[model samples]
Target: MTQPIIKLNPHLFFGGNCREAMEFYKSVFGGELVLTLYGEGPPDAHKDPKANSEEMKSKVMFAKLSGVITLLASDNPNNTEAENTGQFGLSLEGSDESIFKGYFDKLAEKGQITAPLIKQFWGDTFGMVTDLYGVNWMVNITANRD
Candidate 1:
């Protein structure tokens, strides 16, 4: 295997909710979503070209974003289990209050708000939430907003 440079997408596998998780990530992180619906895109996605067919196309072979950051997501190949989202979480770090606040509000929507965006003991604006899909996310807004 050769080393791949410049990661274009961050692949995340789900037991069965890859699509939902990806959509939530899109809303949390600013990005354009180009999803390849199963059997809706080309047939060059499968590892085995011969296996590439309409039936395979609709498996969410690829979903990408081209903006501030490139985010790529897709469903589990077939049997791979999604990582323990609780043990692993996606953190959005920045110093912009408005932007961070905007994301915090959206992420909290339909999700459990574990912590509200307020001044923490660390002297920073921070909050935490687990989205509707049970994906844990943390958003920290530094105190020095400028």
Candidate 2:
């Protein structure tokens, strides 16, 4: 039997200030940062026009700060709605590649796969998803040994 080994990482969700937030953090820690915009995400991730507004399509879809630590973030494309989704999301890091895909498939079943799992410029297999409960999740599998 095999089960996914998951580690929690801080996932941030902003109205549209995700890049700003990551920039600020970078200033503090001075680490390598990688960012992806909403428009860069998979097509399925933009099905919700409200969450993928013209102004938001270019907003930060995912960001990672790898300096003193690893901090993950993104913009809440669904910001204008009545209920604010707040400024945070839960991130999951898996050690095993297979486990990572398994978790992603299971979680995405009843949720929205905001970012289709794919290879990122930062050399990581990553994706973003919003669970059925409206909780945002970011999953990553490191592509190389650091």
Candidate 3:
């Protein structure tokens, strides 16, 4: 009666200011906007003046393109004179939910888990984690039939 959801999609992962970059990408590749989600997380904090930067707050937390491809991002994750991770990765997705779970679990053994494999607000079974080498990885199994 129950079958694991599958995600047949592609996503792009970026360092910081992903929003601005996505907008730039939109210019390069045209696609009608479907949705843009902003993290309620207080990116703006008086503790650090950088956090209060008007321009930074407006950066992209996450953006979806063409209804299928997704752009995943965060604000540098560095508060102080932090060294830029300066690293990026490409996400791969497919339907077989179980297979992806196994893959993600194994990867997490030596890495960081950003999101656990679970139903997402966007109606998809999704999870994100970084590998031991500090590479971000996203796995999604679609819950939405569409």
Q: Highest lDDT among the candidates is held by which one? A: 2
Q: Could you tell me how far off, in angstroms, the CA of residue 15 lies in candidate 1 after the best superposition?
A: 3.9
lDDT of 2 at 138: 87
Candidate 2 structure quality by residue, lDDT tens digits, 8-111: 56776666667766776565446899998877766657667865566777888789999645788887766733234535566777667886777677667667
Give per-residue CA lDDT, model 3, range 72-100, as digits (tens): 34444343222334265545477778766
Which model, 1 or 3, shows the larger lDDT? 1
Backbone clash pairs for candidate 2 read none
Measured by TM-score, the strongest candidate is: 1
Looking at model 3, residue 77 earns an lDDT score of: 30
TM for candidate 1 is 0.69
Task: Report lDDT per candidate.
Answer: 0.69, 0.72, 0.56
Model 3, residue 89: C-alpha shift (Å): 3.1
Compared with the true structure, the alpha-carbon lDDT of candidate 3 equals 0.56
lDDT of 1 at 22: 69
RMSD of each: 5.2, 15.1, 12.3
Candidate 1, clashing residue pairs? Answer: 38-57, 38-58, 38-59, 39-57, 39-58
